[model samples]
Target: MSVRESTFPGVGALRQTGRLFALAASVVRLTFKRPFQKREFVEQFWFIASVTILPTALVSIPFGAVIALQVGSLTKQLGAQSFTGGASVLAVIQQASPLIVALLISGAGGSAICADIGSRTIREEMDAMEVMGVSPVQRLIVPRVLAAMLVAVLLNGLVSVVGVLGGYFFNVIMQGGTPGAYLASFSALAQLPDLYISELKALIFGFIAGVVAAYRGLNPGKGPKGVGDAVNQSVVITFLLLFFVNLVLTAIYLQIVPAKGS
Candidate 1:
């Protein structure tokens, strides 16, 4: 009788596990590092905001208008057209703002971050940093992750306010609802909890997206093909994870929060 010993069950499994742990450790340590470099953070912040803003604004404004139009038309048919304002406010604050921001960020900043790090990896820049006694995790990943989280929160807030206002203008001024009435409905519908949830979602999403993308990008195989594969994988994984997180958060919030007027 003879027995064959398996080589740890799979090819590269040990290396993959080690890298995974390294990435997790990087995230934890970076989170605790004090006196974070403001310059590095600001540079990443600028790049992310600039890359994401245009597409976000474009999508959100039109989404707001479409929501307004649909709700207005439906309510008009039911002789409750004024309620359109409320619907627009609720939709934008609770769902549209966060979702739209995530989409834009995933498309623009996510890919860019992944590509930047992947290119550096391919060029041995990360290795260079390691050789020079510099921690790439501290110098590169930390600042960008923190910046992405902050940017996501700020961008979502801006998107919520702008989208709601855009919807109001379209529904009230252009579509003939009274401005006073629309504002009143908007105020009633946009509760503090809704805005809080949206911002929280954005913060979580940004952190997850940044970290996941960074991990994939920084560990890609050696060369141009590897870089492209990393970028594509980053985008897909980020989007899927973002959606999954959104669902989980939504469920938790629904269960924990008291119902309106309850």
Candidate 2:
């Protein structure tokens, strides 16, 4: 392919990125303007939470169990089996919780948001609202964004707890590790800061997923096919952005929060 052809895609991506950022800023700005949509926010929160809770719990348990199994085996090899709980807890809290929440947000919540908005766009509801002098960003997007952020933080905590418990069960019952040792060592390498960082990561991830979904949905090209494509793009774009954000956040957290006993 010609250099120009390759460059065109990059240029278009950059433009899209800029538009998403601008839309996010607009949502944030409009969120605090008077006459907040309390009903819409509450409804969105319930919708997102109801859809995500079961899936998040199911995913969290397996994730925790897998981590426990792997960490337990490695620790045994290193003669550090007693520290299994500590390692598992740290992994679940610092890494797994935020990542899982992000994936769920994108896979479940993001797609739903995209499809809902896309349908409204295809039906010309958005245009009707605009013609009526209503700001769809403030009325529709802000509530979803705020709800995602709130639910994500709560879901992160739930995932962390479930993951740790799953790890405990796996390590003690499945792997023949001592239950007392596993419980005792859990806090040995964890601290308050880890929980704080995990919540923060979830909040950021939720906001990004919500914003990206909203942007894609709001700007769908033209028809039923456009709605389907927008939903697909929203999930893909949210995942890509979330992974990059997670990497950067993880690095920053590690640099700022010294490990326990370090």
Candidate 3:
């Protein structure tokens, strides 16, 4: 374990993890305090969505096609070709879609947020707010974090739809699979919880991205270069946290939710 004399003396990752959760809680608490920053939230939502949506859709198509192709090949080999659509689409919806959203949001939206806030922090705007009896977390960080969560949920649904379509197209056209069987299999195998978990993952990931970015922004190093470094660190840290959280959530979900026909 690494040690940082700044925050936690004995450990590095654990201390940062605690700090990140603390920041998240602050953001959540500020979310309920009014008058809410509707305009800031709207602006941030539009900005994040504008930057992430197109790239997400583009990435999802190829992502879905690849999963469909692989699953199709496997099922065909096992003489379970009729289950290809269900297996492939479910994989895309339940796993790949949220991961894609997390990646884009962290890489694009989260990085932008980190850079913007880090710049403001280094410029002493955060301190000025403190001196003026203003809460920077309430005024700035809260809206951005909330916006990321909302956008992520919406984008998760969009990615699931587009990804399922892409997967279907590939399975049916490229793999010479039957469209009817594909639809039927998916209908038979997919449950409402599959979608619920996917959107939940996106929401959680979005929150993680925003909180990590904001936290790093709040504590950047001593200069302009530090802001850039903070942005990179925020993205990397968010990615690692998202993946770990995803694994844990997926395990819990599988244990709690029974499979179809099981």
Candidate 4:
């Protein structure tokens, strides 16, 4: 190998990336070839939702309020204060809501998945499953990943509605914005695709989170400490991937979908 390729750091990261992609690919293939695990999927869906719903709702209120306050301030200065609703709504629905779901899912739900799987790995439950001729990826990983995707998509809508209402509440009560103007601005500037992209982002982010967590869980380093470390790594890696993917998706969407007036 060349000097840089021979280096431990570069090789380690590159190998890990390759393995993650491989696991993701296996997941996609297995997802289609399934005697689908409906019960496990339902259990995982509820578990993820229970952990994420309250936090997503709470964080969104402040997130929406902040976006409204910032946009409201800028619009006031530009003498287009009535457009605050449109601007803030676009910001929350198109960007903030999905990001909120991604962050929370990775932080709470993803970590939990990682830790759960990691714990099982260290305990040899995964090995036991393999010995019994059960494919752990199909038995465990696929359902969790699908559940995460579904939950993320549903919660994206929840966050969108809650965020918009929160923004509306703060804008009207604190910023002296009229409800009619706020609602009208949304109608004027926002369109259906904004919501579409937000939900799509959520779906992809969930898939990323679930696959990363399951991958780490499946290949935890060594022992209890290793499992703990893997859990942390999974969360951090998923977060980084989420933002990078979000950037790419946003760029692609912008290119493909013309803005409201343009």
- Top candidate, metric TM-score: 3
| lDDT value, residue 96 of candidate 3 | 96
Candidate 2 stretches with Cα past 4 Å from truth are 1-11
Q: List the residue pairs that clash in candidate 1.
A: none
Instruction: Give me the displacement of residue 213 in model 3, in angstroms.
Output: 0.7
Error of 2 at 160 (Å): 0.7
**Ranking of predictions according to TM-score:** 3, 4, 2, 1
Models 1 onward score TM values of 0.85, 0.94, 0.95, 0.94
Runs in model 4 with CA error above 4 Å?
A: 1-11
> What are the candidates' C-alpha RMSDs?
5.7, 4.6, 3.1, 3.9
How large an RMSD does model 4 have?
3.9
**lDDT score at residue 105, model 3, on the 0-100 scale:** 93
Instruction: Name the better of 1 and 3 by lDDT.
Output: 3
Residue 69 in model 1: lDDT: 79
- List the lowest-lDDT window of 10 residues for candidate 2: 1-10
Give the alpha carbon lDDT tens digit for every residue of 1-262 in model 2: 0011111133577777777788888988988897899999999999999999999999999999999999999999999999999999999998999989988988888899989988887787877888898888888889999999999999999999999999999999988999888977886878999999999999999999999989888777668787888888889888888889989999998998898889
lDDT string for model 3 (1-262, tens) is: 1111222223577777777777888888879998899999999999999999999999999999999999999999999999998998889988999999988998999999989988898888887888898888889999999999999999999999999999999999999999999999999899999999999999999999999888888877778778888888999888899889999999999999999878
